[model samples]
Target: MTTSLTIAQAAEATGLSVHTLRYYERIGLLDPVERRDNRHRRYTQEDLNWIDFLKKLKATGLPVRAMLHYAELRREGNTLESVIERKAMLQAHTLCVQHTLAELQENLAVLQRKLVLYDELEQAARAAGARAPRNSAPTPPTPERMAP
Candidate 1:
């Protein structure tokens, strides 16, 4: 027998609110969920797996419209053309994520360089028996002045 969870259990397990799960269903991101005799939704393991994949896509900054498009493509069944289209979508999204990651890394390097400069300034002040201003921080070097 396949293990199934109620909507509440599915929400808890997926770390999504019950309302969000219902919204996903209503928005066509999720297929209409199976229902029990009492009309409560019963989420299968397959449902949980799909939800997990959706969360991953969201975390990677895939826009909701894109995610919905992917979901629509997925529902078309696994024909060769559908597979090719899905692969193309994922490839394009991967490039977008890579670009964002590169930008973030560049920004992080700037912050690290600024921290190093602050540390050097503090040491210089201490060596010269000077006290840093109580309420003001030293202006950080401009990007042009910062060491490459």
Candidate 2:
């Protein structure tokens, strides 16, 4: 027989706070957890895996409601249409996040270059025993040219 985990054990295994576990149960994110006769929640290995998967889903930035909907579909068992729809939604979200990350990375590179230039200018002025004058600034890198 597979060993069952108590709520506390599940929480520890899943790295989720006990309150969050309860809250997940309260919401539709999780199915009704099985309970012992005395009213203690008993989690199976499948439950643990599901919680881990849920954490990954939450980490991916899916809204709670959307996640709940996905969970509901999953609970209804594997359906071709539901699977395809879920995959499409996840793929779209992944692409959006990837694009956002690329943009942010480009911006960061531009800023880093500007900082480096400023550092060089400051060092030069300090060596010359004077502050850098605020006249004719260097050409700034364009957003388009910041790839890498």
Cα lDDT tens digits for candidate 2, 1-148 = 8899999999999999889988998997888899999999998999888899888778867778888988888877768988887788789878877887899899999989999998999899899999546885767779787678
lDDT of candidates 1 onward, in order: 0.95, 0.86
- Local error of candidate 1 at residue 114 (angstroms): 0.5
Worst window of 10 by summed lDDT in candidate 1: 132-141
- Tens digit of per-residue lDDT, candidate 1, span 77-139: 998988999999999989999999999999999989999998999899899999867977768
Query: What C-alpha RMSD separates each model from the true structure?
Result: 5.9, 7.9
Local error of candidate 1 at 39, Å? 0.6
Q: How many steric overlaps are in each model, in order? A: 0, 0
Backbone clashes in model 2:
0
C-alpha-based local distance difference test score of model 1 = 0.95
Q: Give candidate 2 regions above 4 Å deviation.
A: 130-148
Q: Give me the candidate number with maximum lDDT.
A: 1
